[model samples]
Target: MAWLLVLQGCAGWQSALDPKGPAAGELAWLIWFFTGLCAVVWVLVMVALVAPLMMRSPARSEPLALDAGAEHRKVRLVVTAVGVTALILVGLTLLSFFANRTLAAIGSDAALTIRVTGHQWWWEVRYEAAQPSRILTTANEIHIPAGEPVRLVLTSTDVIHSFWVPSIAGKLDLIPGYVNVLDIKADKPGVYRGQCAEFCGAQHANMGTFIIAEPRPQFDGWLNDQLRAAAAPTSADAKAGADLFLKRACVMCHRIGGTVAGGTVAPDLTHIASRQTLAAGTLTMSRGNLAAWIADPQGIKPGSHMPVVDLDGDELNAIVAYLEGLK
Candidate 1:
């Protein structure tokens, strides 16, 4: 019985009940209100059904003229039920309208705008700024300041993908050639998990992302760090790896700032080592995982858009070492 109690839920970081922001709180309230309303209505319906059966007397063999009082009572009950149902529906419709308005108002004065582009199995996150140099780009992980509403301009380069972070906001679809705006604000500093809610391909289940909310100063510092170019490889193996990376076809799809390997087709590797995860969110960033991903992407994530780059043992190790130094 205790083991089964886990079904009650732990209010995890990904849980809607564990709201960390205004949008999430509103959504959570809506969920609870509907659930409680339905439960109460269901109970009342069950009681009404059971009470009539219990109060019912044995059936008469020969039916007599219906009583006027009983007929009036039945009519009153039906009328009341219909009125209640109508009220409930109207209330729900009004609630939905206001909730949508509230959610829209949250993003009405968005202080910061982030353009999120969905790929086959990864997310391309970009911080939009007035100045071209201040425009920063990263992948999978998104950093936003606490207490400030951030507007996310969402779109998909390929098929449809839904962005859902239960703790922050509701799901919004990213349809190709269509732009959708979602507003989110975190009340406090925390890391919230997100996933691609819509089914796109084989690795759709593994397509995950993270929203790291922090203080203004910390977020600014992070932005500065991410804006810089990839750190130069100092070690012998790393230098060799860097050379091999440029020489190989890996440079065609990926981009590394301050280097000739500039390609817009894949995730920007300017700060790959700084990110928490690899290949969208399939694997955590580590030496082994980096090497494994570089060697065989198809093995780890089947149907991934990234092709398997041919490399030998030493070459693979060198490339991984170089990428690790990118931070």
Candidate 2:
């Protein structure tokens, strides 16, 4: 509770400037409105609570009494009416704000269609209608062009999932075979943290991702590069690593650009090396972490769909080399 209070204090009223969710702004307004209302009500209630003690007469043992006159009755009735009217006005004001703006914001439409399909512990991301009937598939990491509207079509492969990015948008449920659309926009270029708000399975704790919202030209360049197939390695060692990756079980579950390792079960590794993180946004994209994850995926992310394929020193090195060369 103490920690929670500290966190709440850290996120003071003006902290809404850092909002990432869809309803964040509107909710901030409501928070301030209620805060003011509560303050007024609290002061009024406190005043009422101590009124008798503070207004006690010196001549009487009991509290002070009001004059039993017609004018006094009229004054009391007017105060009561004013209080009730204020309460009613507050209720109506809240109802109006909630009904009109909240639902409309949820249903708003923006450009850029990105389908996010939730799996057991990973996310399958697909860019829809980028071309004529062309869809590009990847995993975990989602990239969007900054300063443009992007509509997310969310779904789940097996169980219920919720998509939440603290710096971009609010939580939306992902149901099977049903696409729940969410609209989001980032004001500037940045990487935002996202998580599976709903618990799905054993690996739910590790089921998180990141949104890389970049400038338009940079995003376009990255998309174009990603749509293309993986290029052959230039060096001899890199070529050997590529051959080893194909020879192993890696090809059965992952896809690389311009290669035969097209499998829909796992993330597209066409440009894995270019990503800033790995293991579905669990670690920073580094060779050391990549090697560790490759050796023991289960240890890093228990209950993941990718099994622990035991690899010796040579094979591990080769696979890491090949994956890193995917850029």
Winning model by TM-score:
1
Candidate 2 per-residue lDDT over residues 1-327, each given as its tens digit: 212222232222223446644455555455567778778867877876797578754574554565469468768966996887698687958766774566356536565799999998889999987475357888888888877778888998899999987556557899998989877776677766677889898978677777777889999898888877787787776788888888878899988867888888888898888876677666667889899899888888888888777788987887788788887
Q: Estimate each model's TM-score.
A: 0.94, 0.80
Q: What's the lDDT for candidate 1?
A: 0.89
> Best lDDT goes to which candidate?
1
Residue 260 alpha-carbon offset, candidate 1, angstroms: 0.6
Over the stretch 15-112, how does candidate 1's per-residue lDDT look in tens digits?
78989999999999999999999999999999988998889566877589577898999999989999999999999889989999999999888879
lDDT of each: 0.89, 0.76
| Model 1 lDDT at residue 128 | 98
